[model samples]
Target: MTGGREGRVAVTMPQLGETVAEGTVLRWLKQVGEAVADQEPLLEISTDKVDAEVPSPAAGVLAEIVVGEDETVDVGTVLAHVAPGAPSPGQRAEATGAPPVEPAAEERSPSPPSGERSSPPAGGPRHRHSPRVRRLAHDSGVDLASLTGTGPAGRVTPDDVERAARHAAPEPVPSPEAPVSVPTRAAPQRVSTAAATEPLPSLARSSAPAANRAFRTLVAEVDVPAAQWVGSSDQASVPVPGSAAAAVVAAVAGALRSHPSLLAPGAGADAGDLAVSWSTGSGTTSCLLSQAGELNVGGVAQRLLAGATAGEPPPGAGFTVSLLQDTDVLFEVAEPPPGQVATIVFGTPTRRVVVVDADGSPGIAIRQRSSVALSHDPGTVSREAALAFLRDVVRRAHSRA
Candidate 1:
């Protein structure tokens, strides 16, 4: 399409990490001939660690669907292609020698051997090898024909074998020392498993215990002073070594560092509940785990946002047990002015939502008039003075509303 990839953007499956071996195609949201935008989800993919939505790297007509659903492919495979604002095939008569095919029709097209839509010749499937896969084969000087089956329906396994067979591959000729072997240890091979963690102390902080039923929700929120907002005061001359969010993360990380306490109650030990909350300029989150010996519910929002914004995730942030702290929060749901929650992590106004896409992130505007300097040596103010500040703001805001 588009004359050999000119102006085309490649939507490749991300290689999350070295330990991450490969992924499976669970489904495709968009398909060939579909109109798509940059960063829009093109397909749903699953790796060992996650079930993730694969986004288009750029906007264009989803020019081609290179991989099939339920197919497993290695990282860096080009799952789909997007050209810069290219019209659907129907609109651009010159591309693909055909017009834009309807998105719904193409996406629902069944996988090969069923022959619903047009089928490639019996010798091979129309869509099989990914563009990146082809490139890698060429670069590694691999003969795909020689590779044996590992993937679905005899599809060639990628990368791991490619890299291994290419780099650390057995040389055409070998040295004698390479065949040396060590004696096996004289012990039985044992498989060990660690138990699931006990609930966090903060999760247990609820005064009223919620019943475990079919489904439910929990809610919490926090406030921020305008002066401490991210954009406040040109945000210091130099980048601070740590963000306010990072501080919150550090506090929570500290909680988990007490591994024995975090582990669930077992082996005759009695556990108590611990309640901790984290808050930062980014947002606020509360944690309640019913366990004994710690209640570190401090700066949860700060902990999460710091980890999210840190550009790298901290330990324990990846678990489902971990949750986001909402920055621009709205407890009451409404329509239009405050749109419905998007299916996935999406940004918003009013409440700065980092979306669940990332681990971390802030809010609220407080006026200088609401606060006053303390006169005593210890820098403390009287209770009556604090009440006046709260009542005054309530009156000011109520009058405005």
Candidate 2:
């Protein structure tokens, strides 16, 4: 862009990340007419994973500001211009009590103007925006350009972004079966597994948005019986010790293979890759589980524990799982950061195993147990898909017992 005055150096947006195509102008540290030194901070830009200050390219007066704070623009777009010994547009406007004017230009081929701060071509309306609205849109994955503002002067608002995000989210599919189970008068109350146990449909499609669509997420959780998994006490005290966690991971991975929508490529065995987090006496540790083939629970647990002891970051995987022992707490779904699809949490084992006698009377056993949960995006993973996978885990664990 031309400087707000005669001949100046053009300052364009710089490339920030390998995957970033656009960035939001978080703020302008330097205003028009301000003097700047080369390499000094001039503005801030934000992307999904980064927030950084952009420095001035050359030492000079800030003659013009092309992109305003809070605007989102493609990389390489002109942000401003700097000219040596020139009065900035803001200063000139103030001194003369006149509106800020565009820089003088030589006769050039006419074209549409779509730069950061430029108005739309004739016949198209102008959109007004504020910093708060821009930040809100950035955080919520909403596009201001796609929204119709209700604020005065046609400015976008926080409420507008939130409403747009909500409207963009996919509608949840109702479960065919009632999730809540009524407690029997004679038996103790059972925790609800409704979130995870929806009946599976023969074929289901993910509600996850396409790359071009607004990013919207949905959360769900399902509880499973701990006894079905840890019926054999000896299984828990074996060579690997925390085989329970490994077994759960294996079961989840195996189940995910059948639910392609939850997997990365939307299908395949590799899509079943998972990251598991298990608690140790010291703290928690995470490890990657590639295939469900062998499921060496003890070996996996040992590696994870070793990494935690050495203070290493968790291994990467498609999805994440966490196991918390000896608590009455049930699993709950939590919001994940950008790019993560789902999280499975296993809570404290059941206090005691319930058994049936020859008389058909339920009695307490010496074995302890707990429940597991799967929190997933309803758009990418349907309730039916998650429920089916959870059920499969219980079935596989029981068969091993």
Best by lDDT: 2
lDDT of candidate 2 over 105-180, digit per residue (tens): 2221112132432444343335656786765455445567888778865577766875674455554643434443
Question: lDDT for model 1, on a 0 to 1 scale?
Answer: 0.36
lDDT of 1 by residue, 113-173 (tens): 2343234335433346766555445433455555554776555666433443323232231
Off by over 4 Å in 2: 1-241, 265-268, 279-283, 292-294, 298-316, 326-328, 353-366
lDDT of 2 at 392: 62
User: What is the total number of backbone clashes in candidate 2?
Assistant: 8
Q: In candidate 2, residue 378 scores what lDDT?
A: 57
- Best model per TM-score: 2
- Compared with the true structure, model 2 gives a TM-score of 0.39
List residue ranges in candidate 1 displaced over 4 A: 1-4, 86-99, 103-401
